[model samples]
Structures are given as C-alpha cells and as structure tokens.
Target: MPRARSSGSPNLACRSATTNCIRCLPQVEWEAPMADFLKLRDRMVDIHLARRGIRDSRVLQAMRTVPRERFVREGLEDFAYEDSALPIEEEQTISQPYIVAAMAEAAEIQSDDRVLEVGAGSGYAAAVLGQLAGEVFAIERHTALGKLARERIAALGYDNVDIRVGDGTRGLADQAPFDAILVAAGGPDVPAALKQQLAVGGHLVIPVGDPGDQKLCKVTRITESRFEEENLGAVMFVPLIGEQGWQEDGRRAASNHLPGASKSQSLPEMIADAAEDLPGFDDPAFGRLFDRFAGRRVVLLGEASHGTGEFYRARAAITRHLITHHNFTIVAVEADWPDAATIDRYVRHRPHRAGTDKPFQRFPTWMWRNTDIQELIHWMRDHNDMVDDMEARAGFYGLDIYNMSGSIGAVLDYLDRVDPDAAKVARERYGCLTPWQSNPATYGRAALSRGYAECEKAVIDQCRDLLRKRLDYAKDDGDAFLDAAQNARLIASAERYYRIMYYGGAESWNLRDTHMFETLQNLLDARGPDAKAIVWAHNSHIGDARVTDMGAARDELNIGQLCRETFGSDAALIGFGTHTGTVAAATDWDGDMQVKRVNPSRADSYERQFHDSGKSRFLLDLSPERHDALRRRLAEPRLERFIGVIYRPDTELQSHYSQAILPEQFDAFVWFDRTQAVTPLGPEHHRGVPETYPFGE
Candidate 1:
C-alpha cells in the first residue's frame, strides 16, 4: 500500500510556509507558517502524481510547485488539491492532477524545450509546463477561456507561457518546431498540421478517438519523411471542437454510410430508431422531459412556427419542471421588451396594469397572448408567491427589439423613479427619435434615402448613460434598473437594426439576435452565477445558423450558435418541428391571423422524415453522446421549413424552406407529427374565416 495521512493532523492540512493554495485554505502551521499547504501539495505529488507512475522529477517538481487553486473557479478553490478533475467555465474541466503530471512526463520536456500546449483550458497544465520548459505556447479554442487562462498565467508571472485563442488543431506555424506539444482535447485523429510542426526528435501528445473516449497517443518525429505513433493509454475528454478536428455536436461522423442499405440506415430509418417516443403532455412520465436538459444553464426551446400550441405547451411544461425542480430563474422569450415587462411584472408578483390592453397587441398577438402563455404565467405567479426569497423566484423577460417607442417610454418611466437628473439628460438625447419612434422602419427608409441616420449617436449615448449609472441605480432598485437598462439597450440596438435593415438582410438579423443574446446574458448576470434560463424563440432564431443556409448562403449568426460557442455543452437547444398541421400565421407582416392547414413537409425535409418515423410525438437527442451513426446519417443536408409570423404558402419552398444539417442545428429535436394552432386568449381571436391552407408556404 501507499502512505496513510492522519485524519487529525494539521500538517496534513496546512501546507508549508512556502507552499501551494494558501490563499483559500486555513493556514494551520505545525512546524512552519504554511505547513498545511506545503504538506498538502507534497502529499498530492507523492500520492496522486508519483504513485500514478509519473516518474520524471521535472514533472513531479512542477506539479509540486504550481498553485492549482488559482486555476479553479472561486467556489471550487477548497477542492483545488483534490485528485479529481475540477469544473471550469465553458463546461470544460481542468484535467485531473495525475493526468496533467502524466501528460507532462510523456512530453519529455527538456529545460530549454519550446513547448506548445493545445487546449490550454484552465492554464494549470501550461503553468506546470512553464516550470519545465523555457517557452510555452498554449492555444485554447474558445476565446473567453483562452483570455482567462492568459490572465491567470500572467498573474502567476510566468512570462514564458503565451496563451492565444485560435484553432489549436492547426498548431502554431510561425513558431513551429516545438520540442514538445500537448493537445488537451480529443480529436478525430492526430491533426496533420500538428504532426508537421513537431521538430525531429519532438513529441506531440493528443487524444485520438470519438469525442467521449479516446487513446492518449504520442507522435514522435523520427525523421523528415516519417513519424511514429504510440498509444499512451485510454482517456476521455471533450472533443477538440474546430475545423481540422471533431465538428460540433450533430456534426457528421466520418464513418457510417449507405451502399446497398445492408450495413447502413437511411435518414428516416435512423431517426425512427433513435427517436424516444414521448407520452401525453399531462402524463406524469412527461416530467422526464427535463432529463435531456439536466445540467444545462440555458435551455433554448424552439418553435416550428410562432402559433403552434404543442410547442407552447411543451416548453411551458419543461420550463415548469426546470423552475420547480432545478431552480431555473429566467424565462426569456422572443417578444418586445416593453410588452414582456408587463408579463414579467405579473409573473414576478409585481403590480400590473389593470385596465391596459393585454401584451402582444401587434399583428402576431396570438403568439404570446395565448391560453398556453396565460397558464404558464399563472403558475409562475403562484410559484413566486410561495417563495420567501425574492431573488429565488423566477422572472420573465423579453429578448426582442421591435418596440422602439415602447422601449423609450419604459426607459423614461424608469428614469422618473430613480434618477430624474440623468433621466432629463436621457430625454434630451432620446427626443430626436420621438417623431419616427412609432415607425422605426420608416425612419430607416428615410436614413437610407438621406445616406445618414438621425439619433444614432444620441441613442447610443443614452444607452451608455444608463449603463454608466447601473451600479448606482441598481442600489435603489435592481429589478427596475435592469428593466430600464435593458430597455435602453433595446433602443440602441433597435435604432441600428432599423437603420441597417435597408442595407440588406443579414446585418439586421444578426443585430436582432445579438441583442436577444445580450439580454439573456444580462438577465443571467443580474440573477447571479447560479441562475439558469430557458429561452423561447422561433426555430430560425435559436437553431445553429452556421450549419444552415442562413449562415452558409447569407452569412448570419443566431442565438444558438452564439450560445454553443460561448457555453459549449452548458447550453442545450431543442428545436420543435411538425409535419402537417394547422398553424396560426398571416399572409403579410401586419395581416390578420388565420388558422391555415399546414401541408405535409416536403419529401426531402427532415420534418418529413420525422413524420415518416410513425411516431406521433418524440424527442430526438442529437447530443454527441447519442448514437454516432444516427447523427452522421442525419448530418446530410436537408430542407428545413421555417414559418415565421408571415407565412407565404403560395411560394412555400422559396419562402420557407432552407437547407440545413439538422444534426448540427440543435442539441435535441422535438417533433409532433401533426400539431395544431395555439388557443388565442381573447374572444376576438379564432374568427371563422374562409378555408385557409396551413403552412402558407
């Protein structure tokens, strides 16, 4: 056996006077001032690293010296010296101490070796490498993680360690011929670029296999024309997410295809096999729907169309589970900020306007002012009433920028409460947009006609002013301040969105979604680190546009792609789809709503394939952890139908259908073989009109 640490020893707890993780730990000096930390670090090196066959003194010494606690998130500092891997931002984890020491040992670094570390992660491994190598170049795929790692490394005064954000699969070229390289993420294969960059007698260590499981392999450059590969051992890691590596979830697997259909399955066949049939929405078993969203920070619930009742009901149910069980604090929807503010107040138990027109008075009013939403808010209010802590109660927010005039009024109302002086300045700045606030699009048209926009600087300044006073104003009333600040932000983004809309398509769309994403981020921040949010939006806005024509053909970005890049596995996107159903939509933007019969999905569309699955309702888990073959099969390009507020069925294919790789679009797929229109809340809705076809494609 190894050594047994005494359960009551203080030296066992207190590191040496000159030891590691002292900032967070209780300093109980036995022989010396920092003996507890010292003993702890030494014990970790001996028990975790050395006992695991990490024999190299350099690796052991580096592990012994580096302060691992500095690498972990604030709350996790207490467990910094533990053997297991620790959680970090972006849903990625710092490697286990033993693994870090082993990888460093395998790299066989010389004192003056120029080492390159891929997937820098928490910068813990890089800091260890800095102790062994003269220079360290680290690459992290995510910009935020890399920046954080850089800051950490800099704080440690490790001037030799350089961390940059980029595709690590390509390696660093200009500063090539590294003596050693380590790739922390598992890739499909050892990247060819990394192999080429390895100097003769150099070694490149990487995990090669599926995203979840892999063999830690090392490539040693033998000569100019040859390299040798040795399997170190089996390991698991997050996929190396980038070009020249494993693609994001729902991306195609390199293998599995159809020749004679003997060894392979077609798209519909695969979907049928993988689809998990769901019970009735009211069934107790339906609570298990939250299983797919377990551990997620932001769960985006998508709708095939704005008026689908099943989509509304399903999302409301799932969100309820998340709130009651998981403490989800925010329900952000794709509606204007001012309109949502009223619902937010009602659900949060704030005073509501008694005699006012219900929200979503716009042409697509039924989308939000539906029975489904009414039920959800009523439950939310009940839940809020039961909670003793105000912060613990869930709140609703809107993430759209269509109501510029309303947003301006909200900002003014908020300013009138806290700081009238700043409000006065804001009014003066916002006054310029007063004439055109009612019709922002018209203002945009005029801006386009004049070749210059009015109130651009003024709106931007107003937004900045609110943000500048945020800290001070928040003390007076945090919720009220958030409302005003977000309204101001919506005004700013809306001003630009309306202006650039005439410049053409993608810019306006991108700005709108970006604003939505920012609103979600702000809500989460205000709610604190533990807050979770469920976003309700159209499929087109939440699906990963990068894998669809929205990005490929038109160069646009949506909240799904943004969340995926930022939150990685922590953000779950579930897209809803239907085959043939009755939908609530309009022929023109402001046209009256009609219950139209939706045609069966086109033969080539994924919706059609789901319908062919012979399951009335089911959930498709598109997470990488699911069947690899199924994802690869569905990864093939197929048409996806998107019916927005205005569904023009006369030109169905041209107006609604767009090609996308379904697997790459969402984390999960919720399919209703046939869905129906939402129950509009007011009696004035559902006017019996002439037989209107569904899916105004």
Candidate 2:
C-alpha cells in the first residue's frame, strides 16, 4: 500500500521558503505533484504575496498551501499557479491570486473568526480563507460549480469549508454574524443581506457598481445601525445574478441605470459644463503643472502609446522646461542601453566610431528613430555644448533590458580593449550563450525543459569575475569599465528573464521591470546626490500598478511602482492619453511599420468623456485641490485605452482597454481629443501614414 499523504496540506507543513520539505507519501505519489506544484506554490507566495505588500501571515500561508491546480480544469493545470484568473465549470472563474489576497488582507481575518464567501466558483478562495479562519461557508449560484467546489474542497481535505448552492446575493442568513465576507462578483450596490449578516467590527468586501466596471468597496460594521464604507479601488467582475442584484438576464430595471449614467445632464452637456476646467496644452498658464513638482528628484513621464506624436512632443516640451528652468539632469527612456548610449555620446560630444552612430534598428524603430526624437537629441547636443561643466550637461540613457545579444557584445568589446586576459575568460563563459544569440527564446525553451542544462551559472560567474576586476579596468577607462560592468549585469538578468518568459508566467514580466528600475537607480546614484531625472515610458509602466487590474490579475509591477516605493512623495508620475488618431505601429512582431488608424474611444471610457469636452487638447490636474466635480469624474473607475508599438484595430477593446482609477494611478493627466502618428525620419516611414484625415473626410 502507498504511504499515507501528509495529514496537513503542503502550505501548513512547510514553514520555510524552499519546496524541499519532506513529504509523507511514497516517492512516486509525491514526486509528480511536489516536483512542479510545490515549487511553483512557494515561488507564488514569495514573489506574488510578500513582495507586493500582502501582509497577513495567515493569508500567505493559506495561499502557499492550497493546490490551485486541483481547483482548475485538468488541461489548464499548467496555468493554475499563474496570477491570472482561469475559467472553471459553469462559465465561472477562480479569482486571480492577488485579488483574493487583497480581499483577504483587507478582511483582516482573526484566528477564531468565521468567514462567508459569495460566488464560490471553484472553492479556491474558500480553501484559502479556511486556513485563516476557524470555519468558512461558501455559497455559489451555479449548481454544477457548487457541486464541483464541494468535491474539490473534500478531496483537498479542507474540512473547515462548507459549500452551498444558492443566490449568493442574499448571502447565508442561517449562518449569520460572519466575521468576514468576500463577494466574487459585482453588484449594482452592496447587498443588504450580506451587510446584515456581518457581525459588529466585521468587514464585507465586494465589487460594487456596473458589472464590466466597478469599485472594490470594503464595508465595515461599526455598530447597530451604523456602518462605514471605503472605496478600495477599481475592479472588474461578472454580474451577480439574483434578486437584489442583476436580473437573471443580467439587465437592470429602467429606473435603475448604470452608475454615473442617470445624471440629469447629457454627456455632452456635462463636458460643456466642465470646459472651464480644461486648460489648453500650449497655454502659458499650464506651465505651473510641472512647477508644483519643482523639487522632485524624479519625474516619470508616461505615454498611452509608443507612436503618438502629441505624446512625444508634449513630454519633450516638458522635459526641456525641466532642464532649462529646474536644473534637471538626465532623460532615461524605455529603449536598449547601447542604443541610448550612442545618443549620450553624441550629446556629450564624445567621439563615436562611424559604424555605431545609428543605434535603433529593431522592431518598433519609429519609437526612438523618428523625427520627434531626432529633434530632442539635437537640442540636447546643443544644450550640452553650451555648458562648461560636464556634470551639468543633460544626458540620455535607456533603462529596458531586452537587448541581451547587444549587451553581450558591448561587454566583450569593452573587456577586449582594457584587459585581454579577462576578455578571454569572458568569451569562454559567454560562449555558452553564443549559439542562441540571435533569438534568446530558443535557449529559454530548452533551458525550461526537462534534463536541459541552464547557462545561469556560467553567466553569473562571468558577472562576478567582471565585478572583481572592476578596479583594475577602471584605472584605464572608468566610464568604459562602468559600462562593461553594467552590461555584464544586464546579460545575467536578461538570461534568467528570457528563461522565465518561456514559462508563460508573471516572473518574467516582474524581472524585466525590476531590472529597469535598478538601472534607473544606478543612473541616479552615478549622477550624484543632487541630480534629478525624467523618465519616458508607456503609461502601463509609469502608472502605479497597485490601482489597476494589471496588478490584481497578473501580479505585475513596473518602474512606476518602484519609484513610488523608493521615492514616495519625492517622485511625481504624469500620464498622457488621446481619444482617436493615427499611430505608428506594426501589424505583427517585426512586421512592416504602418500608420494604423486608432479606434475611437469606447462609450464607457475616460477617453470618451474627454473627447466630449469639445476641447482639442487639455491637461487635467489630479491633485486633491482640483475642483470636486472634475475629481469626482476621474475618481470613478472607467475604461482606459493603452496602445503599444503594435496595434490591431479589430481587437482594440480586448487587447488595449483596462479599467483604471485615474486619480489614483497618476498625479496628472494630459489629453488630446484628436491626434496623429509620429513622423519617422526615414522615407520608408510614411508607407502607412495616410495623407489626410479619413484620407480626406
């Protein structure tokens, strides 16, 4: 007979970070599950929960112990550990890990507390809560999902959990006075039954408002007939179907309309009324926007898309003001390091070899190799020439870490010039990667497979050797040595990043952003304590992820999150957006550049509201002192469009729009009602740019 499995689940049994904890089951019974599942669960707890501020220890332990794969469909077990939501039976889904963690952390579960869970699709969240509380009662609306959840819970040995099938909107009255309640679906408003069932001092966390758009609200029972509500942030969920919620058909009565849609004035009228608050982009009065952030050490500039001309021009204009008036020192962007270094050499008048003059030649080249960016480079060069002190000159650099091959070459070339012996060792270690230089993904696929050796050790050893010999090389050429060392670090990080990407999980995304943030920090430290810098990247990178679904669903963080964590009030983040326009993008990866037409803003989006304002262009300050009406409009969650270097108009909504709490994500926002694509410097650029609006409306 096979040895009995551990009485306690893996989560409760392992107190350490590693998945090497001994199992009670026989070797074969344990190897299959513990090999992949236990290791992934441990990583999920460390990276997704601990690093993201998910504090409650009980919540973390429960999350780590639960076998998420058992709760998902068999074929999708590979994706069970991911932070994203996955489909379950009866057209339901298991809540994303971060979302569940957020709700659990918000509930502040006590050791002896009883919990109530609404819309328990897969019973995954219930199992997690069971670990934190004394008992958990989960209600599901779909009969099949309820039955499946019960079976999963029993099979997983969660004896503290109980499953029931009913309209979760009404809650479980028979088991009243729950210490905490978590609703997995969105409702028009907080359900009365759920509120009444909560004991004093208990919390009810639910997504409240429209189904496709909602606010995560936490309601606390203060006393008899007294309760408090706090808007946690924006969220999106399917409708809660039942009495006192959405109708069985998912429609509301005529008297009850979507949130913000029942106002007496039409959308156009509301925009016209707020016209006084809209300031022209070119207005001299608008200069005060950056003026308020005068003493900030870092200012992050964000663009909705990579190829919007207005975004590039606007950020450049602001950057110029900062350099000339505020004494800002550097401009770092989301491009390859070597490519931006070429621009840095040009601006500082350093000699550059002929072949290295043009730096950007990759996919989405228009992002940096365009006329708009060309003008900025020229201006920086002229400005630097006027400055006598080298330290005072504004410099350009790149913070992204996607150029592994280029970085490897840069490191080798530097070592070859300074220390031939070190170069030989470097070449030997890097040789392990040379075979897959053109496409790192090929190596990643192999490394992630069974029995395939990883080059991680070799790359790390090479980085260590370069750092050990840094002083020797620095004596000859300090800047070159510094560049070489940074490249070595980038290569090691990128090698691991590519491998993680092959797993199709959040680790790779997190690694890339973390690398960029570290690069920015290094640049700042190298510039001295008094230096200031401005960052240019997509809104998705510059906007705080904690307030968006990106964070909740994917456990992803970006440069903006790092800045906020590191600099706090010392950093300012500003975002840009547009309603409709032409954008320079490609149909596919490495495809031909095209000036594609951006779809008009959807009806439920913030862009639609801005477009209706009848202003061609404007800036809306998001500070607390702004007009209450303007703040109110932006405070509510709404659809926000995000276009990258690639665009597909047909799948715009599915691919781009995300529900976002505008005021919470950025300090200020700039909007252009109508815009056009950036003009590429080369002749081949306009092959996709049409000559007229609608090609002549």
| Top candidate by TM-score | 2
Off by over 4 Å in 1: 1-265, 353-357, 450-454, 684-697
- In terms of lDDT, the best-performing candidate is 1
CA-lDDT, candidates in order? 0.78, 0.76
* Candidate 2 structure quality by residue, lDDT tens digits, 316-356: 88887789889998899988887787778777776563445
TM-scores, all candidates, are 0.61, 0.64
lDDT of 1 by residue, 525-644 (tens): 999999999999888888898887667645678898999999998999889999988988766445688998888886547787788778899998898968888786677556678877
Candidate 2 root-mean-square deviation in Å: 10.2
Q: Which 10-residue window in model 2 sums to the lowest lDDT?
A: 12-21
**Candidate 2: regions farther than 4 A off:** 1-288, 449-454, 625-633, 683-697
lDDT of the structure predicted as candidate 2: 0.76
Worst 10 residues of 1 by lDDT: 11-20
